[model samples]
Target: MAEPELIKYRSATGRWVLLATVLGTSLAFIDATVVNIALPEIGRGLSAEAAGLQWTVNGYALSLASLILLGGSLGDRFGRKRVFMIGIGWFAVASLLCGLAPNIELLIGARVLQGIGGALLTPGALAILEASFVRDDRARAIGAWSGLGGIGGALGPFLGGWLVEAGSWRYIFLINVPVAAFVLWVAAKHVPESRNPSAARRIDVAGVLTGAVGLGGLTYGFTAWPMRGPGDPVVLISLAVGVVGLVAFVLVERSSPQPMVPLRIFRTVAFAGANLVTLLVYAANGGVFFLVVINLQVVAGFTPLASGIAMLPVTVLMLLLSSRSGALGQRIGPRIPMTAGPLVCAVALVLMSMIGPDASYLTDVLPGVVIFGLGLSLLVAPLTSTALGSLDDAYAGIASGVNNAVARAAGLLSVAILPLAAGLGAGSLTVSDQLHPVYRHALLICAGLMAAGSVIAFFLIPNRLAAHAPADTFCDPCSPPLRPADTVRSAR
Candidate 1:
């Protein structure tokens, strides 16, 4: 098939493409944040313990992280538009299942399915923009995508809070059906088809299986450790299996002719350093996003709507400042912003830890959230650009997928392990007396993680992307790369 003509960013077709991709990707992004706000309501409704709540969040992250690399590869070989539409349809169906689920077991199962659909579409949305837009307009198009998508993320908590208060936690998931249906119609009608002509036909089934099993085992072991103790046979076995599976995954990637994750990309020091920073920073992020809302409601005596609204500032700051930060990184270097941002966030987390029973929102919550927002806005764009910019354009898809997978996996593990590390026992997430101290300890740990990330950035990240980096390489913290590299596309 002939390559479709790349359109100008301001044209009608460009606008439609942007709208479809934004809405589709937002479904996944919003779901990630929104569910955190609804967790308390879901717990009360289902009579679930802390373990069940953690699983509800980690289940989605696990599937998405494990299969995201494969998802990018599939879109490259199949038509991107086709895979994206399929993902929307799949995600919508999974959301329905989650809404109607009668038990915690069914809800967690449905969440895993939703992650599968997220894995399929998240990279495809960015890839479509890279493939569909003219070279001159690509950067502008991506910048707009990032800013617009950030709005969805910013609104997620508030929307989820309102839904939970207005009626049921079920509406948070159910609302996606109509929005997704509209996205599907727009995508099918206006989105053009594109693919990597040289993409590999072989799929790396072994890599995918091992990675999934590895993440699943580790997540289950950690989540169960607090309730069942480290000495429990089940926890021991799960931890053992997790270790073995991850080792096998690495070995498989090293030997496979067409690996799902080409281990060679890590050889680029900048790429490797950027991803390491991502792991540390996002691990802290995962803990904060997961626990802070719960703390506000359970410990601080805030309403659901109030807790959700508290987080709006972080997203708002990112939406407003991210583009300027990206430009600043390009002009000076990523190292300064990358290093300073996390340190700022570390300070913010320390402040957040001070909130307790009867804490005032104005004095206790607003200060930390505003500071955290400023730090995140500074960090995200540079980190994203450096990770992708370090590699050649051909590796864009794979690079984006790897970085995204690291972020998701970091969040998955943090949510599973933070409670145990903080000394919270079974079913203590909603208990104020037990939770207040645990929440304080957990935020301090997250602060340490962010501080460590800053250290990594200061020592490891370069002052600039490599000399050969693409001129049009622009940042999109919300999305990944535009296309797959030649090595990835032709692997056999």
Candidate 2:
């Protein structure tokens, strides 16, 4: 009787726990995307050139991606609750540091520390949710929470813009402080501690070392190569060392009793292919958003607030479609939307390439937003469903961590590479002023990459959803399917 009562209490508390996780997780996503709208403000305020501003965002993502899996491992080995509290506490502190930092260099450093804190929080947050919620409810909760993160990500720029318009860009980071404080407090009261019961007693130090060094060096080199010159020894050395470290990590994972990244999981085609798709999709997204933000502000001369408002055309649609795509995939299949969405995005990119500075938002940006949002929304729900469903329950934490890391890694890589795709990193100007041409070309590349992803999804994803159709709880409680059916029956 006492145990049942305890279970009921935990379940009640678990709802709030997941809510806190949503806040915490969404904070990271918002900082990454929405903040891009305000980069010009930050750049001007700090007297930073383009590169410095880029680093402020990229550095956080880079650190977060590299360390996330390890963070998950740490949470598993230690207590997830303990790690989570520490992560939240540190994240709040780092946000304050970022808000207060006097110099560009200090701000970037603080952002990196904040990433470290996010890395610790993200996986542990999800793991706790999964542990608390049972299977069907778990899927729904995850979908809803993931959708919430998406909404937060989409809503981020608007929030940042409002803050920038009212206060300094510093307020963007400072704003996170209160949100973080609330989440931390709620999490403290509600979230329970859990650990990997089966984990090896000893830490896999070798694997951790290799993963950090390898991923870090490779990502840095990719970002630096365009500006540093291809022949630069620093670029070559970083790449070479990164390659070696990666190989070493692979070897270590194979031999270790416990591993940071389990090598065997990649052997599954669905798992591996899905993650590959995730990488490519996120990479394109990361790069594309940056291009859009820069083009709007620099080329079009839109204010931070204006740029964010202009973005509502895309994100609102994304929220609408994502909530429903899961059911649509279940009824028919994932393939139709999967193939069509990217193809549409490709079309949008092509249209964007043709638009000049004088192009109207309706004619240029609107069409692209509609297409891109539809395409991306199609991709998100199915990709998430497939990835999670592909694995056994035992690997949930690992799978989520790996998938999240891949997406972040892809975003970071895109940031590094797409800027160079312009082929004018240091050409006639310090940075190309009218990057419309470059933006056009880069967006076209994104379209092409997305087109390729569509093909991969078509070929790789299973034709049918699971026998137990999981509802995307993040969406409307009444799915579209049941609504139409109910209407038809009422006529009888």
Candidate 3:
């Protein structure tokens, strides 16, 4: 297979392409966190169980995590721009349906649809950016994308809280409609199409089905087990099916000629280590975001608006520093920052666990939030750069997709299992005193996970400059070196 000639997009063209990817991916990132702030409101409105509320979040994440690899492969085979536009359209429609849903079941179903759309656009956005820019510009472009995307995520809780307090939680989904429309228009008008010419064109339907079924069953089992007793037939059946399906997926992937997730990438120590760290760190991160907001609102007597703005420290830090961190990671390599960042976050989480039911935000919460935010600012950009940087450009889409899926899966499982693990099962979510202990336990557990991540990074994440002895030797020898100017298959 011949490498496709890369096109150097003009400065103006790069700006538009960046705009579209940032906005397109932001739709998914924002939606992921925004809904968390509204969960309390939605639960109240719908008279939903804790498990039902969990499902509303996990259902979307499950679908997105399961299908994202396939989505990336599709973009690599088909045109990335075309697939991205289709995803945006699909997401917009699903958002509309979510806003209109009157019951928890319908809303969860709609959210699942939304996740499918998100899976398509999310990886394609990163892949498109990677293909559009030359290696010299790629790091900077990704930095900007990461920083701006962090802002979108930071804004979600604030926006969702405002909506939930002033009007309805439905507006959270409705807001995406206009944003998606603008992204679709800009992308179609200005973005060029690109695909991996050497990638296999065949879709892995069996892989897709088994993966989805596996994720769906596991998410369902975990989420429902808290509400329905562990002994319930539904819980037992779902867990059994989920385990079987996941095992089957591994077998199928092993046998398939062109698997969606090529098992060979795991052979790269840096790649595998980065993803392993991703799983642990994000699991902790997800538990904090999902549980902290709800705990603040329900236990601490915070209003929706206050709860939403409480995490502003994280937003401020990321928006200000993530781009710089990305550049720093490029120069210094990812090992130091990745190792130190999670340890800082672990300390912050331990600090956060001290906030009791009658705690003050300034004395107890703000300090922890600030430290946690700083740790995150240090970690996220470098983590992303390292994971994708280690892979060949040809596998950029799938690589990004795999990492994204791991992060989502982490959040999905944490949201489902953490409350139960913390001993705040079924009827305890809304009670102030009951949730205080849960918050403490959950925060401590999260801290442990972050600490473990730090340990893993210390041992497994290689300092490529020191180890490989060449600045551009980050990728595998099988692929081309990461050069300043690399050709992409582009239809201008």
lDDT of 1: 0.80
Model 1 bad stretches (over 4 Å): 1-15, 32-62, 97-110, 129-147, 157-171, 189-196, 222-231, 423-434, 467-492
lDDT of 3 by residue, 421-486 (tens): 888766587788888899989999999999999999889887762221111111222223223343
Error of 3 at 253 (Å): 1.2
Across 141-192, the per-residue lDDT of candidate 2 in tens digits comes to 5545666677787777778878889888989899888998998777766655
How far residue 477's Cα lies from its native spot in candidate 1, in Å, is 30
Off by over 4 Å in 3: 1-10, 33-59, 97-110, 161-171, 297-301, 423-427, 465-492
- What local lDDT does model 1 show for residue 467? 53
lDDT per residue as tens, model 1, 117-142: 99889877876766666543554556
Compared with the true structure, the alpha-carbon lDDT of candidate 2 equals 0.70
* Candidate 3 minimal-lDDT segment of 10 residues: 467-476
Query: Clashes in each model (backbone N, CA, C under 3 Å)?
Result: 4, 1, 3
Could you estimate the TM-score for every candidate?
0.81, 0.80, 0.84
Sequence-dependent TM-score of model 1: 0.81
The better candidate by TM-score, 1 or 2, is 1
Q: For residue 111, what is the lDDT in candidate 1? A: 98
lDDT of each: 0.80, 0.70, 0.80
Each prediction's RMSD over C-alphas, in Å, is: 6.1, 7.5, 5.7
